[model samples]
Target chain A: DQQVKQNSPSLSVQEGRISILNCDYTNSMFDYFLWYKKYPAEGPTFLISISSIKDKNEDGRFTVFLNKSAKHLSLHIVPSQPGDSAVYFCAADDTANTGNQFYFGTGTSLTVIP
Target chain B: DVKVTQSSRYLVKRTGEKVFLECVQDMDHENMFWYRQDPGLGLRLIYFSYDVKMKEKGDIPEGYSVSREKKERFSLILESASTNQTSMYLCASRRGGSTYGYTFGSGTRLTVV
Candidate 1:
């Protein structure tokens, strides 16, 4: 079963436009959420994160919004650039049980067209 | 900076052969994990170690095992390789502090024939 889900397999947006990637989770114990970006050859790199305590966290052009009630979170990038084209993954972790287990989404491939 | 290094970038092996993938991290994090990435199946954890000589099985650990004799080093072993095992393997480390995340290695693409 897919505990965490990213329904959109691919997303396309024009440069200087807004790009949003959405993720949903089934398990409610997850308190920490993270977003990762992956290129073709390299491993996934941490992009941004948000805690369960807050609803939104913004860093420069990247922002993450979390809604605890709906078990959903999203990543938004403003004025998207060509360099931003890559696969994005959403990960959720529950520290209450085994702090090590993290459930990840299938990933959304975002292509920012210039 | 925290850097996680994988021993190989690509590997090809035959079925039933033993395969070893090594990972080393510069950061002295207490937690190291092994995950596999496949098409339509983002990343699935195989195993992890919180301390030296300590190991825990993650979501998918049936065909794999791990060894962590040193703090900075972790190894994933495939006792009998299979074609379905062909996928990208990733290694990551997280500090014990509440930071609660990981620094990842480049990745290893393994193909079993």
Candidate 2:
């Protein structure tokens, strides 16, 4: 069973526009959520993270919003740049169940067209 | 900076051969993981070790095994390589806590012919 799921397989956005990538999880025990970006032939790098205690977290042009009630989270990149084009993965972890073991989504390929 | 180094960037092995993928982390992290990424499959954990000599099986560990002899190294072994096992393998390490994210090494692309 896939605990974490990224419904959109890919997304294309114009440069300088807002790009939203969404994720959903079935496990209610998950308290920590994170987003990672991966370029071709490279490892996925951590972009942002949000804890269940907070509804939203932001860093520079990236923001992550978590909705516990809906079991959904979204990563938004403001003024998306061509450099942001890569595969985005959303991950969830239930610390109480399995510490530091995260469930990853299939990932969404984001393209920032310049 | 934390550094996780994978021994090989790419490897080609014949089917039915034993294959070993090695990972070393310089941060002395207690937790290390082996994951294989396939198209539309995301990252599937094959094995993980939270402490030296302690191993845990992940969601997909059917044909994979792991070893953690030292605190800085984790090795993933395929008893017998299969064509279906060809994928990009990623190694990651993190401290034993939920607050920190994982640091991944540049993945190794393994091909079994």
Candidate 3:
């Protein structure tokens, strides 16, 4: 069973527009969430994250919103650029567990058209 | 800067052959993990080690095994290569008490013939 899900397989948006990627989790035990961006032929890089205690967190052009009640989170990028085109993965971990095991979503491929 | 290094970028092996994928982290993190990425499966953890000579199986560890003889190195072993095992393997590491997540390696794409 997939604990984390990214329903949208692919997304397309025009340059300088807003790009939003959504993710949902089924397990309520997860307390920390993270977003990772991956380029071709490279490993995923950390993007942004949110704790269950907070509703929103922002870093420059990237923002993450968490809805604990709905078990959902989204990543928003404003004025999207062509360089922002890549696969985004949503991950969650239950810090209460000593193992620190993380679960990952299937991933959403975002293509920013220029 | 934290760096996780995989020994190889690509590899080709025959069925019944033994394969070893190596990873090393420069940050001296206490936790290291191995995961495999398939077409639609994303990334699934195979195994992880929290300390030297300590290993734990993750979600999918049927045909795989792991080794953590030292603090900085972790290895994934395939006892008998199979075609279905042909996929991208990733290694990652994170600090013991750090709030941040893991730092990943570039990944190793292994093909079994």
Each candidate: what lDDT? 0.93, 0.94, 0.93
Model 3 spans > 4 angstroms off: none
Which structure is stronger by DockQ: 1 or 3? 3
Instruction: Kindly list the per-residue Cα lDDT of model 3 for residues B1-113, writing each as its tens digit.
Output: 77999999999999999999999999989999999988678889999999999999999999998999999999999999999999999999988765679899999999999
Query: Which regions in candidate 1 have their CA more than 4 angstroms from the true location?
Result: none
Clashes of each: 0, 0, 0
- Give the number of the best model, judged by DockQ: 2
Model 2: how far residue A23 lies from native, Å? 0.3
Could you tell which candidate, 2 or 3, scores higher by DockQ? 2
Model 1 Cα lDDT, one tens digit per residue, A93-113? 886665565689999999999
Task: Give the CA lDDT, 0 to 100, for residue A55 in model 1.
Answer: 99
lDDT of 3 by residue, A7-40 (tens): 9989999999999999999999999999999887
Candidate structures ordered by lDDT, highest first: 2, 3, 1
Q: Which ten residues in a row have the lowest lDDT in candidate 3 chain B?
A: B93-102
Candidate 2 local lDDT, B48-103, one digit each (tens): 99999999999999999999999999999999999999999999998886578899
Q: How big is the positional error of residue B9 in model 2, measured in Å on the Cα after superposition?
A: 0.6
Instruction: List native contact recovery per candidate, as a fraction of 1.
Output: 0.60, 0.74, 0.58
Give Cα distance to truth, residue B18, candidate 3, Å.
0.5
Candidate 2 yields a Cα-based lDDT of: 0.94
Candidate 3's DockQ:
0.74
Error of 2 at B10 (Å): 0.8
